[model samples]
Target: MRPAAWLTWGALAFFMLNLAALVGAVLVNSFSTRWFGTWWPEGFTAAWYAEAWREYDLFDVLLVTLQVSLAVVVISVLIGVPTAYALARRNFPGKKLLSLLFLLPILMPPMTYGIPLATVLYKFHLAGSTAGVIVANLVPAVPFVVLTMTPFIEQIDTKIEAAARMCGARTSAVFLRVLAPLLVPGILAASILVLVRTVGMFELTFLTAGPDSQTLVVSLFYSVSAAGIRAQQTVDAMAVIYTASMLVLLVIALRFVNPTQLVTRLKDPAQ
Candidate 1:
């Protein structure tokens, strides 16, 4: 085979190998009754999952995780679309500054925003609520959505919008009928990116999420923290389930948006 093909195959093999190893490690720990210094599990069992399902509140945390992630998706799309349009289509005073401002959360450390954001949320009585989580989460998501959607909006022919206006298509109608269909790819890309990020978020949720609103990651952290190595196997089981769920979501999201279009959305504006 050609050198490029050989390299591609080599890289893919390396990745799959690592992925398999990781899966095996988690699986062995999760399914084994005892995992010490041994190279392999002495026996396999479903007790961890059984305990988790029958006794633990993993399902509650999972539900909260779903709620927050979905809220982030909706909030990101609502807020990001207009900002993306403005950034992509117009050149105004402080345009660069405005762009940078939207990006502050993405560039800044979670602690930087989380500290002050928590205080503010407390003042508003939303500190431990879903709305608070959505607001804090938007720090990462809005910028991501804007960044994803900008390129797609730029690629769309502006003259089509202008012509639609000339033909008596109001601004709302143009966006609703003409631009909306073209945005499907970018929207899906942004939604998936936002969903994955929101689901995996730890620090912000760790700090702000109340017991009633704790996400899976935060709950898992507490579970592992409280139980120590004895719980490692169970934690591994939960991680495996979480990873599998995310993988399924990513596959479904991929089916909605092609890699080419997703890449196009992330490309440099001039390209």
Candidate 2:
């Protein structure tokens, strides 16, 4: 191989090693009793997990996270799929500009729009609640759904819908019976991606959520930075739990959705 190729591979390997080491350290520390100056902790214990579960009120936090994620997924799918159908079936003036407008929310950083969005929610007395967090998350999620589903809808033949119409099918029936069955793969992919994004989203949720509305990620942030004396192990344990939850969700999602196929559909809409 060329020297540059060797150098590139060497750098990639070094980056992977560092990432693995950092994750490994956190995983180990989550279970460690103490390690002031040693290669490893003198002992291991699972008590930190319990302490974190209690101190962090992880059950409630996780419940809120689940609720927020699920609500975003359902609402985004309902709103975005129909909007995508319209764009797919119709050619209208300013369609290109409208699509670009949809793309902006997904392309821009959450913090960029989150402040204004939060301001709007607060003005309407919706901020600092579960509904507010859901609405904030939906801004990016719905657009993501539209973009992901648009290609899938485009790949579908219009003749199928025409045929359904010929069979005396109403517009609603055409969508429910004909288009929906074929769009399952796209819907599942978009839903899972949205769910993951909601779980990880911090800025929007943080800006909109109250004490009772806080999700797992927000609670984790507070555990790390909020003023108080807390055990490092407890915080590490919470991190582990967060990581494990995401991994488990991904694993389950992958069981049904082929990520490579999803990416291919997103990248090559004509396909």
Candidate 3:
């Protein structure tokens, strides 16, 4: 191999090694009983997992996580799909500017808008509630669904919809029978992306979540810092569970969605 190529490969390997070592250490520590000043634990135990689940009230946390994630997905999709269809099919003035506006939320860091958005939610008495979390998450999620579904809608031939209309199909009938079936793959992909994003979203969720409305990610943060002399293993166990949940969602997402295609769509929306 060329010298530069060898150096690139070496750098990649080093980064992968560090990442693997970090995850491996966490996994081991989560299962270990005792490991003070030791290379490994004196004993291994699964009890910490149970303890973390009960002490953290993770069952309720997971439930909240699911409820919030699903709500965000449903709402984002409903609001996004029609908007995407309009943007994809119509040629209105300032369309590019509107598209760029949609891109802004995704392009900017959540922290940039999260504070102001949270303030607005709180002003409306929605903050520290499940509705607030959903609304906060929806800020970015709706745009994401728009960007994701836009390409899918565009790739679809408009002639098909026209032909359906030519068959005397009503607007709702064409959308429900023809467009929706054709859009299934795109809808599924967008929904899965929204699901994963909402599940793992920390900044917005953290800013808006309350005691009863906490998602798994918010609850995990509390487990780390909520004024306690808690067992490290228990915290590690919770982290493991959080990691596992994200990984499962990612795996399911990858099964149906092509990352390369999504990236291409994002980079070249005109296509």
Candidate 4:
């Protein structure tokens, strides 16, 4: 193998080693009873997980996270898929500019726009609420759906639509019968990505969510950052829970959508 290839493998190994160590440390700490200047804790226990769940009201937070994620996924798909179809098929003037605008949210840091977005939501009395959290997440999520689905839409032959039209099918029927089935993979891919993104989204959720609307990630942030004499083990337990949830979600999503292939197609739609 080439020296460059060896270096790339070495770097990836080093990164993964560190990542595993960090996550392992957190996992151990979450289950640890006590540790001071030792490689291992004095005892192992599951008490911290129970404590964190009860103390943080994790059930409600997880429910809120689920609600916000599903809402964002559904809304983003409903709005984005059609917009993606239009962008994929049309050749209007300013189309490039419009596409660029959609890319901005995904490319830019959420903090840059989240504050103003929260402010606007506040004016409409949507901020600090579950609906506000959904809307704030949608700002970036809809664009992501648009970008992910656009490539899928572009890959389909226009002649398929024409054939359906020639068969006396209405536009809606053509879309439902022809395009929708073909676009299933793209829709699933986009929805799963958006759902994951929304669940893990912190800045926008933090900026917009209220007590009742805080998602798991935002709630975790508060638990870590809040001033108190909270147990470190409990916090670690919370982190572990959040990590486990994400892993489960990814596993379920990947069962239906191959992320590697999805990304490859997005990068080179002509394939």
Candidate 1 regions off by >4 Å?
A: 1-19, 257-271
**Which order, best to worst by lDDT?**
3, 2, 4, 1
Which RMSD does model 1 reach against the true structure?
A: 3.0
Report the candidate with higher TM-score, 2 versus 4.
Answer: 2
lDDT of 3 by residue, 130-215 (tens): 99999999999999999999878988998998999999999999999999999999999999999999999999999998899999
Q: Is candidate 2 or candidate 3 better by lDDT?
A: 3
TM agreement with the true structure for every prediction = 0.87, 0.94, 0.96, 0.93
What candidate 4 gets wrong by more than 4 Å, as runs, is 1-8, 264-271
Q: How well does candidate 3 score on lDDT at residue 215?
A: 97
Task: Give the alpha carbon lDDT tens digit for every residue of 82-143 in model 4.
Answer: 99999999999999889889888988899999988989999999999999999999999999
* Model 3 local distance difference test score: 0.92
Candidate 1's TM-score reads: 0.87
Tens-digit per-residue lDDT, 110-183, candidate 1: 98889888998888888787778878888889988998887779889999999999999988999999999988
lDDT of 2 at 143: 91
lDDT of each: 0.83, 0.92, 0.92, 0.91
Clashes of 3: 0
Ranking by TM-score: 3, 2, 4, 1
Q: What global local distance difference test value does model 4 have?
A: 0.91
For model 1, the run of ten residues with the poorest summed lDDT: 262-271
TM-score of 2: 0.94
Tens digit per residue, CA lDDT, model 2, 68-152: 9999999999999999988887999999888888888988999999999999999999999999999999999999999888877
